[model samples]
Target: MVTAARLGPEERARAWQDLGARELDVLVVGGGVTGAGVALDAATRGLRVAMVEQRDLASGTSSRSSKLFHGGLRYLEQMNFVLVREALKERELMLTRLAPHLVKPVKFLYPLKHRIWERPYVTAGLTLYDRMGGARSVPGHRQLTRTMARRIVPALKKDALTGALLYYDAQADDARHTMMVARTAASYGAAVLTSAKVEELLRAGERVVGARVTDVETGESHEVSARVVINCTGVWTDDVQEMAGGRGRFRVRASKGVHIVVPRDRINAEAGMILRTEKSVLFVIPWGTHWIIGTTDTDWDLDKAHPAASREDIDYILDHVNEVLSTPLTHDDIEGVYAGLRPLLAGESEASSQLSREHAVARPQPGLISIAGGKYTTYRVMAADAVDAAKEDLGPGVVDSVTENVPLVGAEGYQALANQVERLAREHGVPAWRVQHLLDRYGSLLTEVLHVAEGDSSLLQPVPGAEEYLRAELVYAVSHEGALHLDDLLARRTRISIESPDRGIVAARDTAELVAPVLGWDADRISDEVAAYEARVAAERESQSEGDDLTANAERLAAPDIRARAVGRALD
Candidate 1:
């Protein structure tokens, strides 16, 4: 059996030692979906590759997306057919062949406001949407009368829509998927290290060669060499290019997108809704037990590590979504708000929403390759292109990328495990829904996660405040999923930070104590982690109440990063 790789503390220490042992074929700098994809692609193509990140995996924009895998429907309306077709093909691959256990189909209703030519116009666009890239894994679009639409969506006002067009798209937990990609790369013999910061680029005459990396936890530095260094750092592209001693071929701009989470019962709908906004579009995406309504697209120049969502941003989404809902939601209904920056390739467009989502790859120097500007759904294509561009530096004998045929770690026997959910739950003495939840999160690796609690069966019980997650999952995150801090376990590994009503404050101390022994945290360290996380949650709450971006950014800066605090490193 091809077993999945475990990225525990011991493996991380070995990766650091191996990083300085010899020259590598590829050194990828970033831990987002694109960077993880690059490592997996290079490793599967038989290249000696290593990926390093300053923080935990998916700690940046990769985790803060709208969580959809659709071929941007708005792009189709913009007449960018090529991008839509390519994205649709990737979406199909993820749903059917690549990560079926992670990605699943979801239905959305495009509510029409006009009684005239709107229906036929939308019908024509959706017909083309259905046929693009042979999207047959999910059902096609269906036209519905107003009554039929109301049958599924009773939350709509009586006169909100003249009719509706329901279509299918796919969604996944972006953070988990990105982490799995990194883990799968490690399984294929790629050295994956987190909390490692790149301080400088190594130069051999006029060409870039490698980098000087810092271990954020222990304040240790290492000089690592590689034949080619690929910069997959989105939104921070120019900073890395400057480190390379010259400006690259392209520039990246940060576009801020904000999303809010409310209880699922707040909007009584059987299916999600898509409404056209004046600037762009609003998606009422259905999360597990919550409805995610977002997002406002505007230019951001303040903070990149932590983007702040202001009162204005929240109000924009609430007002737009309320225009069609029977019950207008207020601030009291909101449970969570998050902001992310999209690294758009700088262009002449005055509005950030108008920028293209197509990715570009360039070899700025003889040994440096940079990839920027793309949607989350098409990361594999972007990674393949970046590695293909590196062939010039690698000389010959480098084979083509074969990641399209490689399934992520947990995807391999998922269907068979899913079929035995009832039996597994009965044997384990847990509820069937708990088994299904584990299956959705871990797929065929459900047994591996459960195995973390071998001696103590109580680890299978639900967490105290956040009942959706199991205590065993927290231990598994620390032991297998590379969760190094309290923030990583709550925010990325399980998503308790944004899913809970109190933003995971109630579960903070208990969770920290639970993972303290695994992380080798003394009592003082446990107190520091808990205090840092609480301060972070408080900062986010205060930032959301501010009226403008500048004030909100100031408010969010109150919380210091736990990993950065050890070394007293300044925020980039």
Candidate 2:
């Protein structure tokens, strides 16, 4: 029986010490889906692994994705059968075997405008999609006429569609999923540390050996030795490769993708909708009590850390989505907005959307390996391939990846516990819906979270401002989920930053105070955390109102990072 891999403050200190004390078989950079997957893959394969992230896990593109786990329907249209099949297989694995708690099946309606030819054409595609990788986890597509389609989505314009095709795909909280992957890696004896930035690559002659990492929280630096370093830094791949004194074999181009959140009532839809745009597809995905509609594929050369969604980007999404909706949505209806950069493999096409979603792995140097360009659905395959590239350095004894068979930390017995939701609710003295909510987020590991509320039943009450989350959840994040900062808790752990209308402002001070004791935060530190979070929210709000990427990026960067500020003050 595998126990829950707790990633509390104690574990973080031990991880830092362990990374410096031993020579690791593999060192993974980046804490996105691919990076975390690589860490789990390497650790489960019986290889010693350590992963370091510059900030909280999934602080980059991983958290800001469209949050789908489907085999790209557009990929099938592009005749990229191999990529689609591989992705569908991974989707099946996630929904059925790997992360049943995190990944759940979601229904989507594809509106058909052309009455005569479109239905048959789409039917053929959906048939292939259902059969691809033996996708039996989700049901096959159902055709619906305009009358029926409008019933399912009353917000649809009468002329918007003649009919629709309903199909199934999987979705997950990308940030939570990535963090769980990191914790699962730690459970398997992998040293995973966040807020540890790689300042430089340690070199021995021509071969890359290790890295000098600086703790972002403290100014302390450590030289961690590893036999092979796998670079999964996503968009920052080129920058990291340059530090190794090599230009690298491939180039990565950043494609900006932005998503806006609106209340579910504004959409008036029973199911999510997927609309075809001239450039690409637009997904109005269901996200809790809100709808997430987005994604513009445009080249971006600005700041990678905080990719801002400008007014034009927001207008583009609203204009396109409004074309199909009966009741047009305005900027006032938007509750939250976020922007992320996709690391596409650069090609001669000049169009970021045309660039390949297929990933590539290369040993740029004897000891350095880099993997990039894959979509979120196929992160597991990317991880496996990345580790395969590092095989020569890992020696003959390292076995093949067993990650396909290995469920993540909270995955085990999830179904059984889910069946017992009513009973669990009775035991916890919370509403059945609340118990189900906890079960979905934490799976069988819900027991561990409830343990935090053992003596104090008030901990099970809803958070002050973010009522969707229990106070116990916030405590659990700081104590066992490696949330080192206020941003980590609100932004990644619970997503209150993006879900709330005020962007977690009302909850910042209360949340900081809740975890103050666990994190050893003094009064000054607690105040700083709340102030920094407020500044971040303000900057993000200001950026969204800006006209262009340049202005938005500048505004977004105005917020001082609390960790950076603390380090500077300490030195002063």
Candidate 3:
């Protein structure tokens, strides 16, 4: 078994020192899936690599995705077969080979509104989708009459549709998946550090040499030297290009997508559902004991760090999904809400939905390669292309990408552990469901995680107010995962922010104190972290109550960023 690299405080400090001490082959900026993918690809190819992120891993757009790894069905209609086929191949890889423990098959029911023509049209699209997937890990489409559909989803309105079609896709915790990717890269001897922001570009004569990075936690700066710097900052691609003082080849436009989480019992559906909106498609995803109904796609020009969901966005989702629901939901039904930005390649179309999801890689300068505009499912392909673009600066004898054959950390013995869930649950004195949950999250690393709570059984108990997670997980988040602040623990590490009805406010203090010893937080530090988290939740709540984007953004900006506070600076 390839043991995962520890990303705790000590490892982070060592990584920072190593980053500044040597001249690396490739320096990756960004800790999202694509950046992590590039680090993994470059490292496994026998190149010295280091990656740095300004915030927690997957803290931005990567964490807030629809959490699906499917070949885009809409792309088939748009005749973007190359993207669809590539994404499908990647999805198959994740399901069967690379990350089988994290990615799982999920079924979605497409309700047909047009009686005579819809079925055949959808059938044609789904047929090509099934064929493009190559090695099939999920079942193909199945047609069902209105009555049959109602039997599967009793929550549907009587007149919602005449028939329905079911197709298979895959889902995962995007944040956890991205974090695992970063850890896997670290395990492959790549230096990975979070809370390290790129302050300036280091230039040697005409060619870019490296970056001046600032440690956000301690306000200390270090210069990291490398032959080539790969920019994979997604929505912040333009910002990085500007920082490099290069002539950017392309522009990235931000598109905001919002999702609301509701209790599962509110919608009595065994299978997830997909509905066609006027602008884009909406997904009613089954997320644990909740149903995640989303997404309104619109152009966003405001804050990139925090995208706030306006009242109109939430109502738009509710109005569209409620069109077919037997029991129409009110605002009170929403347990949590989140918004994220998509970095689309700027095109002629005025609408964000019309922009291409296809990625682009360009060597705008001698030693700087910038990659932008890609879906999460195709991140590996994007990463490989970025590294390939940097080959000129990387010099000779560089090897090809080997990540397709390399399984992520914890994927090796996941199935073996999965087969022994009952035994593990009994030994741990937890329920079978708890073992299953841990298996899905940590896979074979569940043992390593459980090892954190060895001396005290109380740590094994569920987190106060957030019963879905154990107290041990919070401790593990700080002691194992590189969670630096309370916000990281509540938002990215455990997803308590968007999963809890109170937006994790009730559990913030308890969780902060839970990891205080590991994080070396004093009483004032714990108080500050808890207060910041609470203010963030309050700002989000107020933002959701606003009528438009501008008002929502203003409300969201009221909360001070904890990371910014650590650096003794304010967000621009």
Candidate 4:
């Protein structure tokens, strides 16, 4: 198993220095799901690999997804059978074999608008969706009348539909899943680093060779040599290409998708729900303690890091979902809101909404291979294909990717541990539900976290406000997972940031204190970290209030990454 101790600031820097000073087979740009997957895919193939990201793993579109391991149902309407089949194959792989601990089946209720025709029409699409791509992972779809559907979703409006169709898919903690993919890559000897930004590309006679990477945290830069560099930067794919001093055969268009989170009780439902919008589709995905409802798809032309979701976007979601809810959720009921950009392969589209989800890979230059425009479900396949194309540049000695059967760090014997959840809880002196939650999040690796909590029973106490789980998770975030900042733990590591109405304000101080000992932070460090986190939350709240994206983006930038400013002061 890959220990959580690897890929710290020191270790990651050394890896980059060695690569810059020496040579490697492949260098992956972007630390989202695809880049992480490519790193693993290449490393397992007996090839030297390194992946670098400007921010944390899954920090971009990967973390902000709808969190489903689903076949693209909308793609069927587009007659994109191949894409749907391809994604469903990956979905089955994740649930049954690849990352069973991380991915599991989830059912959704599709409300039928028309009295008769829509039921069979939607049923046929879902039926075909269940059949394709070695789909042994999830159960088949079920048809339901309006009355029966209301029982499952009691809060759904009476007049909204004639009937509904219940169908299965899978959900995951996208940030955690993406991190595990990177950790699995590390276990296979891939040099994985975060907060490491590529300042420019290294070249050898017009061929892209490696990169000059800057350690954004430490204000240090190093050169890394490689035979082939793959661009997996998603929306930032074009940025990476520009850094390499040139163009590609294709361009990526940014499409912004926004999601809103509300407490589960806000809309009482036994299962998730799917609804149709005038221009696109919406989903209320079942997340623990809360439900995830979103997504507005439209052209995005501003800052990529923080894609602002305007008041209109929020209203658009609430308006559509309220159309079907008996007790509609208002703006005050929302717990959190997030926005992510889709890296669409730009082409002949009258509007960005009409763009395709299909990905494209190309060796635009002799030594650089770029892949862009695929869904989160098919990231692995995209990674494998990215590596396959890179083989042409690297030549012989590239072995076949062995990542398909490889389980992530937490996946080994997850089913057995799940079965023993009650016994484990008894042994650990915790509730069975608590054990189940840990096991779901960490699989067999839950023991590692529990062991720490056992050392100090204080760690057993839950966070101050968002008491859904234990304090040990915060410690585990720093000790086991690579959570450097307070935001990383609360926001991505455990999701206390989004789950609580205070946006983790009540929990941030406690979480920071828990991780401080492990990180060797003294009084000043803890204060700085805590203050930065509060500032971040404040900025986010301000951003959400703005009337539109432009004002929202401006508000968010108010809390710039002060780490850079800190480094500058130290240097001066």
Better of 1 and 4 by lDDT: 1
**Window of ten residues with lowest summed lDDT in model 1:** 563-572
lDDT against true structure, model 3: 0.92
Give the residue spans of candidate 3 off by over 4 A. Answer: 569-572
- Tens digit of per-residue lDDT, candidate 4, span 333-393: 9998888999999985856667888889998888999999999999988999999999889
TM-score, candidate number 3: 0.98
Task: For model 4, name the residue pairs that clash.
Answer: 20-223, 20-224
Off by over 4 Å in 4: 1-5, 8-21, 133-135, 569-572
TM-score of each: 0.99, 0.99, 0.98, 0.97
Model 3, span 1-572: residue lDDT tens: 56799999999988888888999999999999999999999999889999999998999999999999989888898899999999999999999889998999999999999999999999899989999983398998898999999999999998999999999999999999999999999899999899999998888776889999999988888999999999999899999998877658999999999999999999999999999999889999999989899988999999999999999999999999999999998999999999999999998488899899999999888889999998999999999999999999998898898889888888999999999999999999999999899999998899988898899999899998899999999888887888999989988889888888999999999998889998888898899899999999999999999999999999999997899899663221
lDDT of 1 by residue, 510-540 (tens): 8999988888988988998999999999999
> Which pairs, if any, clash in model 1?
none
lDDT per residue, candidate 2, 95-144, as tens digits? 98999999999999999999799999999999999988534977799999
Q: What is the lDDT of residue 375 in candidate 4?
A: 90
TM-score of model 1 (CA atoms):
0.99
**Per-residue lDDT of 243 in model 3:** 84
Error of 3 at 431 (Å): 0.5
Candidate 2 at residue 155, lDDT?
96
Query: How many steric clashes between backbone atoms does each model show?
Result: 0, 0, 0, 2
**Of the pair 2 and 4, which is ahead by lDDT?**
2
